[model samples]
Target: MAEKGRPRAFDRAAALRRAMVTFWELGYEGTKLTDLTAAMGINSASLYNTFGSKERLYREAVALYDRTAGSATNRALRGAPTARAAVEAMLRGNVDTFADPETPSGCMIVLSATNCSHQNRKVAEHLAEWRRTSVAELEKRLERAVEEGELEPGTDVAAIAAFYATILHGLSIEARDGVPLERLRSTVDHAVALWDSLVRQPAGRG
Candidate 1:
């Protein structure tokens, strides 16, 4: 309970963001109440009053991470000049950011999906839904490319989308494993080359 004279002036959103990053780095099982409070700069009572419990706070944090990270990927997907370019750029951005030494925490969604227990089904389901949405968006982009003559009409859009999704998942693992940045870049370049091979040129025009 906070003192009557000293009001709780904490920024709730900012605190949740901090908590998101903390849990992202340490994981649910590893994160302690003290750790969260310290990172959030709020006392235990304030935290409980605001968020109810650690699990509830974690759920909020996960939602925040999903929105923030998903928006970034969505922006990259929409901003690319072409479908192939969009996929390449999105995957490259993910690899680069995840592998950056300055990125004190790796990907939150990936961490949760891989580490959280069966009891945390909601978290797992959220991550799976996000992945499905990503794949669907990629398929839409690929279909657009087909309509624009960028890919052959017969190209398998669903397969291409799945391939890119797999690449993104692999990059997340590599980042968690502390793979060297140079190696990750090389791998991304290879992935781009593979994706390029699938693009369909104008019919009868080489």
Candidate 2:
């Protein structure tokens, strides 16, 4: 059923990127197949052939978003000079981007989970798994800080990581609600200060 001379050269990555923005703007339930096909610049059969189904395509789009945006937090956490700096960078970067008025779409995971029913369980599970991985990664970094004497040996790394992770979810919600960048920055600042206070000082300090 191929068109006479129309070549079949769909850019899979580019299509997924477009799909990501569409889904980010319109939640799972709100986005129709027609909307997705138009956004992706493909026909129904082509879209289905390329991505399998709407649900499958949505999952791929979420995965793409996760790799681009969510992975930035992971990279920041791993690249910073200190554990505190890493955590601060991760939290601050997320809020800064999420609160940007220039960002055409809101937080995809947050919007999807709130608007979609259990039919979108795969998307929900993907987001949940990403959060769990983030928290665990932070906990490991905190543990490393303790071993390096940057944090108290008795510090509850798991608890602190969980606390910060919860704060991140709140920030995502705030961003979705269109909170101002300054307010989001202030919130992150307060959270960073609280985190700083928990650092373990060197022994025999004044």
TM-score of each: 0.84, 0.86
Q: lDDT by residue for model 2 over 118-158, one digit each (tens)? A: 77776677767766887899999988988988787777787
Task: Please report the candidate that would top TM-score against the real structure.
Answer: 2
Computed on alpha carbons, the lDDT of every model, listed in order, comes to: 0.78, 0.78
RMSD of 1: 4.1
List candidate 2 segments past 4 Å from native: 1-7, 199-206
lDDT of candidate 2 at residue 202, scale 0 to 100: 33
Question: Candidate 1 local accuracy as lDDT?
Answer: 0.78
How do the residues 95-144 of candidate 1 rate in per-residue lDDT, one tens digit apiece?
76677676543567666556567887776676677678878988898889
The TM-score between candidate 1 and the true structure equals 0.84
Supply candidate 1's per-residue lDDT for 20: 85
Question: How many angstroms is residue 115 displaced in model 2 relative to the true structure, after the best TM-score fit?
Answer: 4.5
